[model samples]
Target: MAGTTWDIPSGATVKVSIIDSTMRLSNMPTTMLFDNAVEDFDHLDRIPTWCLLVESASGRKAVFDLGAPTDFDTYAPVYNKLMNEAGLRSGFKVEKDVAQVLQDHGVAPADVSSIIWRSEGLPVSVHSSHQHLDHIGNPNTFPKSTEIVVGQGFTKAYCPGYPTNPDSPVCETYFADRTLREINFEPGPAANPKIGGFRAHDFFGDGSFYLLDTPGHTTGHLSALARTTHGDIEDTFILMGGDVCHHGGELRPSPYQSLPDPLTASHYPVPAGLNITGCPGAALFGALQTSRGRRARDEPFVDPSKQLQEDYAASGRSIREAQVPDAMDNVFFVFAHDATLLGVVDVFPKGANEWRDKGWADTARWTFLKDFAPAAAKFGEEK
Candidate 1:
């Protein structure tokens, strides 16, 4: 397995907030995210895409991921068709783009300063976590001065998108007049020892924020780690996990946090209510069914191979270990597709910079378990 250890500079800190683009989707099959399941699973999951806005104590600003496009069908037809066929739809109302979201939160579009995938320019430049339609949104929607920064290999892989490629999922209009920059990943101090085997680029050069090369969910996929502070304490980090895993379960019940033993379940509260014990991670599965009406195992629910871009099992293990309970106090994960977060942490206008004070991690740690309660109950009955 790839190493799961991360290196955080002692006393390093930054200001981070969750940007609620106010996007939402109605449906997604559980099998697409997990193995061992039945197809056409109507999870009605809140497929929300979120971006993270980070500010250094010195006032340098950066935004990650743009959430969803309001006019998605028109922006990217191929994506629209695929999503529509899969029962997914646009999630937000009109004018909910990133620029508007920033403006609504008191930061005018002109104040953006920079879009950090890895550092600034209201020079209107934005950093895309990946090329997915949802993450790119309508970059064209930004001011004419805006440019876009993407991970390495982006243009070569999907350039001449849309009409030119005919089947490309990205909009040519989005990149028409914009300057696109790709980050070149080099083995540095962050990557020499390996943080979950990820090649990281220190965005701020002060060790306060890092853009990790975690390429599994999609090619050139990137995730971030931002050091933050509560009151006097430092050495805390908030991980902006971009599409790492759609649901929390995929990275929970780690070796560091197995299902609570029944004797200690009362202390945990949430999982106790579901009466779940032992490692529930393995028991939790997708909703795809076999030809004989039994739930499918080791079978993909969607086209091509599984949606997982790399070794799925290894990726899950790396994430789970990196986010164990001992690390929760100083580290927490903010996944792009986790809707359970809506109720747990303060949204954009209100920075999650104070998550530690709010006990946000503890509150959300087990919320994903509720989705598996029925399965857990059935397992209990069988036992």
Candidate 2:
């Protein structure tokens, strides 16, 4: 668990940049994401989609997660129906697709060597983190030479997509005339080794990037870890957590990184007239703990939605394992829909390799706690 360490070799590093997908899902019910037993908040005001551009030292480029398609109508009829049934039609909005965003940034689609999601290549290959519509994007936009990479069970689960499997969430056109490569993480003579409690494949074999087997959100959910700076006193990494947890509350306050005591204004701006300068961390956030067990303080504020998760227990383990690197100063964890990072971090066309030197982690770490302002205010009033 918390004691686990990553054995990242010292070698070539990659340049990573965040891409604002211009996709926004607003006014989503909080209950749809996690249990709202404590009733801290009613709705998630804004959910922004974030994608990443990874470039190896050798000039090979890859895009991680395409966010959402510009047009919602382009989705499979079944997926559209599901969204309508879930009453999410009005909430979903995308102003531009990933391809368009890339073009706007001066990076042509054809020049991108790979697009890793659940899939990865130059001529461009698309990797999908999972079969979710938001991440799959519109692979058809890329040249047919662009391959498609996916996780282990993806082919059997949703292949021959759409009309071929009427209920499929993906489109058959995505895989049409494209090379579909599925990553195998099983142990064998040439199998990928374990890195920090995860089965990892060295994508470039130069220690620049790795694709981790992290299932639970879906059948073939994948996450990536990129070495941004190496051959230094301490190597810095950016863990591209693909929906490991939607909100920061679900990943923070682990045993390794407990809530700061004597909570300060810098970490969280206390609402005015609280009549208190500083408060004990436990006392203020105690009620917000969804778990009543002994390790409630060490556990997350909220759990993953069972309805959306394929395996509830596995998802919990994945999140807990992620807490280890997250507590480290050298690792910066960014998930797909973290709105807290909207304007805080530099977006695409700007390299995120200097995150460590820029102190982005320290600034972004406690910002997520602002969402719990209401709970803190209530605690202050009671005090």
Candidate 3:
């Protein structure tokens, strides 16, 4: 774990609030997104899309990843047709847009300095993690002065969207009449420093926030690291992992954070007649490891399948790189669609800056194992 440590520069801290974007997808096939050959979960039900409200110390506010629009019709016709064909139309629903969620919390849409789709910065801008429909939201709701920010190569890949390109999944209206700024992660005077194996840009020109160039999910997929608390000896961070991997299982149990020896019933409750105390982590969930042949104790439960990823190999690399931060005790990694945090962490109206103090990381870490309870029960019975 020596080389895995993050050399974080001491600096200002930001206020982070987890926003329940109100987007939900139930009964989604696990196989559609992940390779679940080892972990046998049929459907990834109650999938929630999470956005973040990041406020810099200077009072500049930014919303990261707007979730989906309340109206599915807001998306491009091609995407809608694809959803209908895939039978995903019924499973998807959104009660409110991110803008409305902010308003309910007393934050006005106009007051939002920027909307980070997947990247982060000051001034009025919208930064998208990728051009995916669920993360794009409705940019039109914000004032035109609020520019849209995206990761590097975003415009080149999906610009002139929809009707203009006919096959584009993005809508041209997202960029119309607004300044569409794409991040340049190239190393130079702008300071694209290497942080945890990814080229990161200091969004605030301070160490408070960094937009990591985490590609693989898409052409310009991005992830973020927010310095929530600064201390003399250590700093706490919240990693806004935007679709790095849909499930926590895909990013956990790395060489740094292996499965706990005695997987307790509190975290992973088993059926009656099984071990009332607890079960050995490896014995209960060993088969869940996706690594072939000689399985390592630290291998993940699953890996992102090639079906949804634009670059499968790159995604694998990014996921591996992400494990470093995920394994750290001071870093709390939250995925965009981690339903495990539904009632676990405070959302929106409550700031998540104190995640460390509340021990949210340890509480939510193994909670994802609940998804494998059925499999664990079956394994216990066979013994």
TM-scores of the candidates in the order shown: 0.77, 0.90, 0.91
- Regions more than 4 Å wrong, model 1: 1-5, 10-12, 38-42, 84-87, 90-95, 116-132, 188-196, 230-234, 262-305, 308-328
Model 1 is weakest, by summed lDDT over 10 consecutive residues, at 119-128
Compose the digit string of candidate 1's lDDT tens values, residues 1-383: 12334555443577888888777765555654566432223364566777888887677777788876677666555665655654445433444888788877787665554554421101011122112446676666566455566665567766777788767766688667667666667765553223455666777677777777665455466778887764463356788877666776556545445443332222222334455454343233322112324433322222211444344554554455345422455677888878777777888887877787788876676566556555544544554
**Residue-level lDDT tens digits of model 2 in 181-229:** 7888886623377778888877777878888888777777788899998
Candidate 2 TM-score to native: 0.90
Q: 211-267, model 3: which lDDT tens digit per residue?
A: 899887777788999999977768889999998888877876788877776567666
Top-scoring candidate (TM-score): 3
Question: Which of the two candidates, 1 or 3, achieves a greater lDDT against the reference?
Answer: 3
Winning model by lDDT: 3
State model 3's lDDT.
0.77
Q: Give candidate 1's root-mean-square deviation (CA, Å).
A: 7.1
Order of candidate numbers by lDDT, starting with the best? 3, 2, 1
Give RMSD to native, each candidate.
Answer: 7.1, 4.6, 4.5
Clashes of 3: 11
Model 1 lDDT on a 0 to 1 scale: 0.59
Model 3 misplacement above 4 A: 1-3, 119-132, 270-280, 287-296
Candidate 2 lDDT at 6 equals 69
